[model samples]
Target: MSDWLSDQAGYVWLIIAALLAICELLIPGVYLTFIALGAAATGILALVFPELGAIGQFISFAAWSTVAVVVGKRWYGANPVPSADPDLNNRAARMIGQSVTVVEPISGGTGRVRVGDGEWPAEGPDLAAGDKARIVAVRGGVVVVEAVKAIEADLPDQPRDDQTQSKG
Candidate 1:
């Protein structure tokens, strides 16, 4: 058994590479795939250089693995995969620009506002309970808000009524 392994060391390396590739498939992350690339490169090296023994093959594998990881990092950094739903995990972030009702009077720039089916801590100008507000931002799980009346006040002017008179 030992003599057979010694004679077919290149095939052993190829088998190791195949196993690593299978593991990469089982795991979705690209980390295992990079390592698999290193193993595959080592197997190719062993096949091309039969005189390179176990020690040399190990050194080659290590060098290739390091290179693979560095290149993978750079490649992933340069072209990040965009998420289908950027706010999928961040519930608070999704609340931005959404309207909320004041569940408690917001005094001293702090209170609670009802957003969707739940209430969230709010920070904004003073507002009495029952007033409406819009979520402007989210800070540390708190929703920063602006009064609806204030937002409407910032809109362009309405039509003039100089020519209008009360019906007689």
Candidate 2:
């Protein structure tokens, strides 16, 4: 095995690199990518210095693999924008500042509210059902609400006499 590997000519490392890349696709992680880079570097070295010994090729692969892993980790760590799904794990986070209605009375800082056809556990000051509230914040799937000013009812009946008596 050592003799065969040592006797190998150019592009053998490239074949190894291709195999590693395929393995990376199958495994679905950041590991094989570095190994593929290493193998590619080895192939380039072999192409440049055709008389390089097997030890030299091995060293080249190891060095390149280390470099690739370090650089990949640093690059990915610095910029971690969730590439998979933008809204995957943040449903309630999107509900902040939305207005909702109190479906259950909040007597002591806990209640239920209906927002967009869905009921959510809520926490805030006392709020009676049928009152309008706005989502102030969200924590662990629980919504926090603040009561808004109530809308006045439009009554066309004659209460002018009562208003005049109260003013007098």
Candidate 3:
């Protein structure tokens, strides 16, 4: 068994590389993949230089592993994966631009406002309870809001004095 393994050292290195690659897939993080590259490189070197002994194979594997890790770091730094939804995890940030009702009168720059089914701490102009406000920003856990301008068209028509009087 010893003589056979010594003769087929190159195949053993290749098998090690395959196992490392599988482990990389199971626990991802561009780390094990780099080590696998080193093993595969050592296997190829062993196959080409059949006279190279165990010590030479170990040195080659170490050198190749260092080189692979350095190159991988630079590659990832230059090309960062951009997220499709930048605020996917930020619940408060996602609420920006949404309209919320002032559940508690906002005074002294802080109060509570209805955000969806929950009430969140808010900071904005003085607003009475039930006044509509628009979320402008989020500072810490508090939401910053601005009073939503009232649209006159939405107001109920009030009769003028002349219109209220009976026509003679």
Candidate 4:
């Protein structure tokens, strides 16, 4: 068994490396890339230094793999794209200052508001579902609203008209 294992040439290790690299393609992420690089190094070492024993080949593979992973991680870490909020695609962002109707009674800091065609979680003063509220702020995809007094149609339209009528 020892002889069979020792008899295995470096090319076999190199081939294993190539297979690992190909496999990395099917699996996304930085892990596979390191393994592939390690394998390629092993193949090169085997092709050039065929006399290296199995233990030596293994050590080389391990050392190269470790270096690859560390370097790849650092290189990737140095340049990271800012992650975008998944909820930014919603249409609520456009309703920042729009008036919305409360869909559910809000007590303390949580409630629901209907803006245009969509309903969103709201945070603000206590208000009933039928009350009208103006969106004051938006954070973490939650809308903040303040209750608005319902205007009565019976109120006079102009202050000047009331004064003139009183004078007459």
Point to the candidate with the largest TM-score: 3
Q: Can you give the TM-score per candidate against the true fold?
A: 0.80, 0.70, 0.81, 0.58
User: What local lDDT does model 1 show for residue 139?
Assistant: 98
Per-residue CA lDDT of model 2 for 1-168, tens digit only, reads 966666564479999999999988999677899889989988988988988988888998999999999999999899875656565668787788898989999879999999898999999999999888999999887899998876799878876776868654
Cα lDDT tens digits, model 3, 1-168, are 987887888999999999999999899597999999999999999989988899999999999999999999999999988999999999989999999999999999999999999999999999999999999999999999999988867668899999999999
Residue pairs of candidate 2 with colliding backbone atoms? none
| Per-residue lDDT of 49 in model 3 | 92
* Cα error of candidate 1 at position 114, Å: 1.1
What is the TM-score of candidate 1? 0.80
lDDT of 1 by residue, 37-98 (tens): 88888888888888888899899989998999999999999999999999999988899999
Better of 2 and 3 by TM-score: 3
Which wins on lDDT, candidate 1 or candidate 2?
1
31 in model 2: Cα distance from truth in Å? 4.1
lDDT of each: 0.89, 0.87, 0.95, 0.81
TM-score of 4: 0.58
Best by lDDT: 3
lDDT digits (tens) for residues 46-101 of candidate 4 = 76887787778889889998999999899889987575864476656656778899
